[model samples]
Target: FVFADVIGQIVELTPIEVVSANGKETHKLTVELRNEKDERLPMVLWGNFATDVSDAIQGRGENAIICVLRFGKIKVWKYERSVLNAYNVSDVELNPLTPEVEAFASLLSSVYIVMCTIAAIESDMGCYYLSCKVCSKKVLNVPNDNIDEQGDEDEMGFHYYCVKCKVKNPRLMPRYKLHLVVLDNPGNSKFLLFDAIAMQILNRPCNELTGSNFEEMQDPEDILLALKDLV
Candidate 1:
């Protein structure tokens, strides 16, 4: 088996197209690869290897580590072998735990805890806001509308407001785009953002905070510090 280290975010997935040539059907897959150094290479998955393309692309987001088997034939155009075959994509790992990964994970975990604590406090105060630490924006909730862009009825929908940015933003932002900033007890700081549902879950209204006026709200930092001590 031809083995090579390949890592990249899945940029595109071509629809499976079959062509008949010389009384035989041929299947091919075109995949784009970008390495850590940001080099781009086009790989072709052919025949039996092409069958595994769907599973390999499933849930594999951008900037993921992927291993590929490379096979190709010499071509004059590039003064190198033209990639003719590829596949057996396995050992797929996301955001590999390198030094950078470890640092990021620690920062994210810390930020997540802080945000959760804030949300818990706010939930007690009967207020909900999606906080973006990177932009320092607070997302506000809007009444659910039963219509979509096409004027079609969209009963299962809601909207949000960003008080800081002064723009209507999507309720669901991509995970990669959101990050957390962490402030450790030792004065170290970092940033992080949770997926939408996680954010809501962390802030789910509780009896202590729910139905309470904002003026009666307590400091989130105090709650966070207490929770931290417990941990």
Candidate 2:
């Protein structure tokens, strides 16, 4: 049995999909891992392995994860080589504290602290999004026909759906996903701020402005004023 151990940062993760394999439905998830040398290797997880990795990422709400895959079988399809789980023998570890993992983590630049001035706030893209309370993943509203007898609309006239959680009418929360153009000594660049990081910068929660509305809307004048204070 050919086996390999891979340690790297998870650079990309695709949404889980159900595919017909041998007349039976099964799950498939693809993740790209980048090693310290900046080389990328694609790893495919099947069946329960796919679901487990997906749940772990959603549960942590982490932008980056250091993963170690051990005893994975190497397979080639269409002349491209990839790694796959060796059934129950394979193992997956996230953010493991090992000499190999620590050495690899030190070479990565994804985590950092910086001081910059806010040149401007990009309003064209808007700010904030309706997210699932369960998984903190972005959710969308779907038409629901199960209204009450009084004909009173639901909280937002429709129930929200989370594709990741596969739940209907799940609890919802407002999360910031804003873009900003920032400047420093060298040059200026655009930076995207996600839920937790954005909240730390603004010192406020997205619900303060959104209230009951789940639809996307531009930040109000007061929010814009607060952003200007950072300039």
Candidate 3:
């Protein structure tokens, strides 16, 4: 089957890796694209095209991208259904010029990007969850002392482990997690601001805030004062 053009959102992206193809090893980047109706199709890109697309998104630190692919041939696996393969002739267009993509911009324009004044900060919800910097995952604190052969006494040492990354580290980082009641001309509503926004509001990093006087961070007034200009 040949599709001259296809439009979809990248629902899943796989890391570029060397895989066995036709009994030979080659780098492959596989992605699952979803249409507006939620139908998904797997597409494979080889070598440079695969590495470029994968690196471009990773460098920008974006989760995913919607794109349009022009011309591809369908290939069927032994046990699986058909999937699309891109060759030298195929062209990829990001945020392509199409009615489907234009609709997204239209929706964005229709919605207002208003900044609301925070009426209340729910600091009680915890300013942040203790996380590991490398993985951005909640870390589990544990005693650093190694258990003896006979499960003996507790010694002086402590560290944290990141379950998501499946690694142990000597320290954990703090990332802000806040819930606030924000006021706008429309009215007041609760808004949850995660780590990124909170960092901008405080003008301090996750490490600094957690390392020094952590208790002072509990006061919402200090945070609101710093956010006066932003909101």
Candidate 4:
């Protein structure tokens, strides 16, 4: 009964107020969708039938393809309907090509640079710490005071905590200088913005690539020139 380009990921699924044909106020089960371009669209379900359909698509994560009926116009371009109004579900697939999907994935992998002095490296055990451009604080082993309080001293040592900020400091404290540069294939001249994680990886304090040390290279033809400068 309804047909329009479905957009957005399912953000919330619940009941919302609707105005019927006779101008009477009614409640209908609805699903909210945010399209690839970040537009919001709502689908509504009417009567008791909305229950089963609502349950089916309720908790579906973002980027799901759904089908719903177009009952009545809510505004100039938007329509009001519910899951019960849905007679069918289309692809129901999550596409990786979407901007939202790509952004989210990149964000998860991107390193968070804290205060030009510390970079939080993502690791299996949690975030591994590294030194910053302007400081000498290394990710060091420390006593887990919290676990120590529970009499678990054996689990202590080698924990990834900043020696400069101290364990008691707030997590938002900036401890490292971070920058990124995107490498296209080898021998290519173009470079892109460096992500936070890439900056952290580059900040590993190699003998030749130490903090701002790359700046000393006199000739543009030097090997260090290949190091993408992402500022």
Candidate 5:
């Protein structure tokens, strides 16, 4: 799709994450932009754009302002449409005093960002889940599947299937999904930290703590130790 501008309130902001794409490590952050009409669209900010937005949210502690994206491109994955910034060509602005923002200023309200402390590990629910390396979606093993030409089954069980991507023997990765109780000003509340936030808090990715083999469950000792250290 053609590059265009998108302005909305930033909501559901994820921590800045470093991921490997095309053999290069890059920073990325995912966020939802909510318009005045309450329509929300998912958008991903990569490289400097990711760090810039994360820094703004950290410094402001509120997400109620308008975000301006210039030259952002639309991306579709599995029939879901989202926005992504065009490399080197896109620009990002948080709370710019533009005419467009001033026109819709009255319709927007600041959303408070909450700060919580980790109280304790809620359960032994494990630390991560197996997901497709391509799309980061959960995948299932295909039974009686033929081995790839590389004969991966002997090394690591092969033939996992992604229902969404519709691929066989797809590469896999481990993603964090921790169950914990967090304490904030109000009270203790249960919080489930998925891969993005969990990696940010843990200072490491799930792959660092576990293996990619779906049939073999990795020892959660490292993950548990990290969680205990946080408490």
Candidate 6:
């Protein structure tokens, strides 16, 4: 009958969509929240509460979503696992000016970066992908019968929440998904790059890699292009 506050990082979140319940269609959301100890659990947000979470900064188009849900109801799935079901009384914040976020920031900025040169396209793979424009993570696709004015099956109507940025986006975009082989001289390693870096290397979007441009070697030319600059 009641719920309390909990702080955790979102692990995975599905797209918000309208579902047929009883005799009507209604909006709903499911999110996986993880805590400092790496424990994760799912939380469901319903109606406007779900809508509000989807529209939040962390739930918006930010490439990643990272935030907290301070209150809600605890829901049990299958009478075994318990999940938090957010209600109208629940309050959600993105990058809230709280001690949890502050601690996360310090750990986030502590990562180190290294420089290396492209040696070879050892394992050239996917050149394009559809991902959350904000967090750049893969967006989940859930089918719903809810039709839009365009009768488009309302595919674009799904709001996908990102755990890294704690935001949600209604749409997905084509992005680069590349794996490059690099070396810092005498040492070789596999390096992965995402949309932003790939765009910079090719000076083109992921959609440009047409079948006509693809070679037997599988995007060797794309590798050549990256060599022009230190990628």
Query: CA lDDT of each candidate?
Result: 0.40, 0.76, 0.62, 0.38, 0.74, 0.59
> In terms of lDDT, which candidate is stronger, 1 or 6?
6
TM-score of 2: 0.57
Better of 1 and 3 by TM-score: 3
Model 3 worst lDDT window (10 residues): 148-157
Against the true structure, candidate 6 has what lDDT?
A: 0.59
Q: Per-residue CA lDDT of candidate 2, range 135-190, in tens? A: 77667556556555344345456666776788986788988877788888899877
RMSD of 6: 9.7
- TM-score, every prediction: 0.31, 0.57, 0.43, 0.25, 0.50, 0.45
* Candidate 6 lDDT by residue in tens digits, 161-206: 4443455443555665566778886788776666667778778775
Clashes of each: 14, 0, 0, 26, 1, 19
RMSD of each: 16.6, 6.7, 11.4, 18.6, 10.9, 9.7
- For candidate 6, the 10 contiguous residues with the lowest summed lDDT are 210-219
Worst 10 residues of 5 by lDDT: 211-220
Q: Where in model 4 is the C-alpha error above 4 Å?
A: 1-7, 15-27, 58-231
Instruction: Arrange candidates, best TM-score first.
Output: 2, 5, 6, 3, 1, 4
The candidate maximizing lDDT is 2
lDDT digits (tens) for residues 51-144 of candidate 3: 6666565454543467677787666577554445466777876666778787743443232376777787776565566766775645655565
Residue range 172-228, candidate 1, lDDT tens digits: 221211122334555533223333333354453322333232222235433322223
Give the number of colliding residue pairs in candidate 3.
0
Best-fitting candidate, scored by TM-score: 2
